[model samples]
Structure formats: C-alpha cells, structure tokens
Target: MSTFRLAARVLGLAALVALLAACATGPRITTEADPEADFSRYRSFAFYSPLAIESRGYSSASSERMKAAARAEMEARGYVFTTEKPDLWLNINAYTQQRTDVTSMPTVDYAYYYSYRARGYYVVPYWRDRTDVHRYTEGTLNVDLIDASRNRLVWEGIAVGRVGRSGDAAERGARIDGAMADIFAQYPYRAGMVPAPR
Candidate 1:
C-alpha cells in the first residue's frame, strides 16, 4: 500500500478504537451507607413516589426503568417488593447540567509574502492561537434507601457521567440498566452471599 494510504488507515483505526472505548464507558459510582443501620433486617421495599416528584420532572418511562432495575437487584439480594408498610423505601433522583469547555491551541503555519526587492516568494512562519469549544451534558443519578418507619436515609448511591442525548429508546434503556447495575454493585449488604465459580 502507498505510504499516504497506510497512514490514513492507521488514523482511521485509532479513531474507531477511541469511539468504541467511549461507548463502552460506564458511569462513575459512589455509595455510602449508615454503619449503624442493620441492613440484614430490611426485608421488603416500596418505591417512594413522593420523593420522585420532589426531585423534578422525570419521564414516567425512565422512572419505571430505573425502578425496575433496582427492584431486580434488590430481589437478587433477598428483598421483596411490597406496596404496604415496607421495611425500606426506594427513591431515585436525577438531574443534568450543561458543560462547556474552551481550550486555546497554538497553531503554526507558513505565510507567503511578495517582496519586490527579492523578486521571489518569501515564506514566513507565524503562530496563531485557535480556540476550541466543546459542549456536553453531564447527568447524575442518586438512589436513596430510606427507613420507612424512621423516615431517615439509610444508604445512598450516586452515579455520574456524560449523558447521550441522541439514542433510540432501546439504547437508552440499556444504558439505564447498566448504570443501575453499577450503582447496586456498591450495596453494602448481601444475603446468602456465595463465591463465584472460576
């Protein structure tokens, strides 16, 4: 292959690898739990709808997806979902912010100037400053586990990452699922834990 063509192919491969890495990236997760609380005592959970409303305007579909993911994870840890008086209440809150980054880059180029005395083209090297603007949206999701009777937060998990605005419903759902899984992986309590097979 020609040298130029080979260089182009290498650049293309690098760009493709970067894109895949970004797509596979998951949200950063942080979790905290009350050390005094008895996690083993919690047996049932119910969604705290009022807290969801207090957070802000969130789509029902998205809320349902998050709740469902949480529900599945809780069940795996030996928790039951109940509408009646429950041992724990689950609440989710999400918000997004717009971020803008501006960077100045130095650029070097050659300029051609006409000189009557030289009777030839003169090349001049000059440096210019170029500004790059990057705009993106960052989103954060907080999952809180509250003691129903005490009305106190027992545990909280948060995940933050860059939010993709243009994706199909299925893609968005998958992202939500993945984020929830990551958040739940931080849960401090596990019922009947077993070692994984190699």
Candidate 2:
C-alpha cells in the first residue's frame, strides 16, 4: 500500500523476467581424428601429455591447463605418464583465438505511467515492462589426445560452455579437470592389447 512497497514489487518481477530468458546451450563436440579409433590393445601405454590443444577464435589458458589435467587424468585411469620416449610418445599441441557468436533476447523496459481506475484512482499496472532483449559473449575451449608410438591418432574431445578469459587459478584448474574428465571418459587408446575391428 505504501510507495516504497510498490517499488519493491516492481523490481522483483523485472529481475525474474531477465533470468528466465538467459539459457545455456548444450556441450559441443569436435574431432579432427577418428573418434571411433579402437583402443582395446592399449592397456599399458604412456601418455605424452593430455593437455595438448587446438584452438579457433579464442584465448587458450584453457589448453595449458587442459594439458596438465590430461596428464593427471591419464594417470588416474591407470595409464603411465612419461616424458623420456617411453612406449608411447605423447605429443600435444594447442592453439586458441576469439570467435563471435550471435544471441537473441527480448527487450524489457519499465517506466512510471498512469492509468485511471473505475474509482477515479490513478493506477500503474506495475509496468508489465516490455520483454528485454540482450546479447552476451561466452568462451569455448577445445582439447585432444594422441598416442605417438602407433603413429596413428587416438582420441579427441571438445566443449562449448561458459568460461572466463582470466579466472581463479584453482577454479580454472578445476574446470579443466572437469572438462577433461568428461572428454577422456571414452579414452580411445587401447595400446597393443585391443585389436582393431575386422
């Protein structure tokens, strides 16, 4: 009933409208090499390094962290990590650049306008507020893994999700760790134990 109470209600409604329109997209997938590469034979193979990266239109601190995380990931999966020309030479290279993506949103504007009620009282429909439209820029990160001894490419993975140019080191590390954990879930390298399909 008070002026302050009416203002508060209008603000809450406006906030809710804005958030409902912003939705995140599903993860993206990119593969330069064969994703279906068989890995039934690579039980005891070594990772050259997992965080090797290839980028397009974006910055790449993500790649470096990816490499480190990949190494940790491979190690976690019971695979050996080596740098001295072991059974498998893991060679990972990464690059990144900025890219432009388009987004669409409705525009919403609120103003104090007057309407008359049957009782001759001034009423503001609380400003239904036109839908607001906006555009926001988001970042994408790509990653891949390869086995050198076989001389054939092995596994690859990619994702397009919310990210930051510069962020908390630990948070970035965690992000890399999480992204890689998903990508390597299918670890396509099988060393010499798994044979290719006939």
Candidate 3:
C-alpha cells in the first residue's frame, strides 16, 4: 500500500459524502406566473373556502400546517389577510407518493495475503460494479394564487422533497415550514409590487 493511494481514496470518499449531503439538504422549488397578470394590483389575500387541501372530505392536519406557513409568508410580504373583497385567493395543497431511486457505481474489492516464499505482503484487487435501490416517500406541495376579481390563477409555487416516515409532530411541522419557505423564495413579487426586470 502506498501513502498516495490511501490519501486519494480518503479524498474520494470525502467528496462522495459531500455530494450526498448537498442533495439531501432541502426541497427543490419551482414557480410559474401568468405574464399578463399585473402583480402590483394584488394587495390583500385570503385562503380558498373548502381549500384544495381538503382531500379527505375534511381539513387534514397537514393542511393546517401548510396554511399557517402560507399565512406567515404572505403577511411577511406585506399582503393583508382578509376574507372579504380580497385581491388574491390562495389554494394550497400537498401530498406524498412512494418513490424509488436506483444507482450504480464501480467499486474495488481487495484481498491481502502473506507470501512465505517472498516474506512479503501482497495485495490483489478485484473491480466490480455495484447497484443500489432505495425506496423513499416524496412529498410535493403546491401553492396557487388566483386573481379573485378575474377568478383565474395568476401564480403557482411548487416544492418537491424527500419525506422521512418517522418524526414528532413538531419536527413534521418544521419540515412543512421549511418547504414552504423554499417555495416562496421562488415567488417573484411581494404584495402590490411589480417584479423588477430580471
């Protein structure tokens, strides 16, 4: 074994770990808005009645967390929460789906032996390919803003992320908030403000 080879292997392993850590950090966010809509006209916001999140014929726990997160983000952007004559109506929803990811990589297998005749240690290396299959829960959240006066959707934000199966209530809530923050980060405008040219 050479010192250089061991150092190379260590560096490779560290790089691999860093790449995986970056991929697992948070959700991927995407957003879309109608080009013709004037964002500056929207001043107040309200959640839709019988919200799209009522997937179970009634409001679910997840829906409540999502609404709370949306409310915080909306108010932070200077949007007033109102029930009457609001400029924008929000329809937020989320669901999880079972997903599988498959990956393949080349690996080296090695064995060591002591040669009595030579009185030296010898190493044999074997090269092979390894495949891994992982199953996980993928959660998708959608936040839609509609022009109340026109009854048309004006903008939408979406987030997709890996969802862990085990967590306390508070932990789950935090995850939802994190996802919402990621989604809203993509939104182009604040309440009653036009987006600057990009």
Candidate 4:
C-alpha cells in the first residue's frame, strides 16, 4: 500500500481513539457508578447518529448501517431502545470545519528564471500543489444521553477528530463504535468519576 494510504488507515484509527478519549463536561452526574445504581431506572432510549456517515468511501446506505452498529453496541451494554416509550433520549450532533478552516490565502512565490539561448528571453515557471491543503474536516461529535423522565440531560460525551474527506462504511462503523465505547468507559453515570488507582 502507498504511504499515504497506510497513513490514512493509521491516522483513522488514531482519530477514533482521540475522538473517543476527548470528553466534554456534560450535565451534572447524580448517580454513582457503583453497583448500587439501577440501570433499569433509565433503560429505554433513542439516539440519532449521523445519517450522512455512509456517503464517502461512505455512502448513505453505509450511514444507516453505521447507526445500526452503534445502536447494537449500546444495546449490548444494557441500554434498551424505544422511540415512543423511551425513558432516556439520545441526541447525537456533529460540528465540523474543513481543512480550509486552518488554511491561509495563496501568496505569490518567486521562481528561478531560466533563459532560452535562441530567444534570449527568460521565463519563470510557477505552480502550486493542486491539492495544496489536501484536507480533512476536524469535527466534534456530541452524544447526549438524556433522561426523558426528568426532561434534562443526564450524560454527555463529545468525540473529536479530523475526519478525512474519505471514509468507508467500515471506517464509519469503527469510528462510531470506538467513540461510543469511550463515552461509556465512564459508565454507571457517576458524578466526577475518576479512573480508579493505577
């Protein structure tokens, strides 16, 4: 594989990890992560993931599949799904900035002039990298695990990364799963939960 392709895959994995690990402060946590809490209390839920995920190497169909995978993974972790009869509602939103967001305007660059012996005229050749800023969109995905019974946000996790212009169905699923897993890494919904002793 080409270096760039390899880089993309490696970077893709790294982005997934980074996004999952990057957490945003969510609503205050009221329950303890210990065995004392009853997850059944806030069981049924609904969550919206990117309907646009499947369209690059990722197509729209892929997005639907990605959502399914995310839902499935969450379900395996004990959360039940329900739209009309949900105790908790999940809302997923994303914010992205194109590579251009970090780019500057083009500037004139000097070039060495080479003279042609026959014409005695010098010409300077200049060109820019067609893909000067071969870009990616840096974005944040926010997952709100809200409590419908209370009508307030209960848990929130924001995953952040620079998503390349190209993502396949596989990549999308990997990212979604990786991100959600990271969010739930702090599960049981404890307030100010810290990692246990090393």
TM-score of each: 0.72, 0.52, 0.85, 0.48
Error of 3 at 129 (Å): 0.7
Per-residue error (Å), model 3, residue 180: 1.0
Task: Write candidate 4's Cα lDDT for 1-198 as tens digits.
Answer: 754455467557756865884564232222223333234566567753323342233345434543565567567666777777687666655557775533333222335565666655554434343223445567666556666666666566666666645557667666666665665565643322333443
Per-residue accuracy of model 1 over 63-135 as CA lDDT, tens digit each: 8888888899889888888999998999988889999978775555568899999898987766677787989
Candidate 3 residues 83-190, lDDT tens each? Answer: 999999999988889999887766666778999999999887666777889899999999999999999999999999899776698889999999998888888688
| Best model number under lDDT | 3
Model 4 stretches with alpha carbons more than 4 Å out = 1-40, 48-63, 99-135, 189-198
> What C-alpha lDDT do the candidate models reach, one value each?
0.82, 0.54, 0.87, 0.54
Q: Which stretches of candidate 3 lie over 4 Å from their true place?
A: 1-11, 14-23, 111-121
Model 2 misplaced regions, further than 4 Å: 1-36, 44-64, 84-140, 186-198
| Residue-by-residue lDDT tens digits, candidate 2, 132-170 | 343444445554445566666665566555555556788
Off by over 4 Å in 1: 1-24, 53-59, 112-126, 191-198
Candidate 4 lDDT trough over 10 residues, lowest sum = 25-34
By TM-score, how accurate is candidate 4?
0.48
Supply the TM-score for candidate 3. Answer: 0.85
Error of 3 at 132 (Å): 1.4
Clashing pairs in 1: none
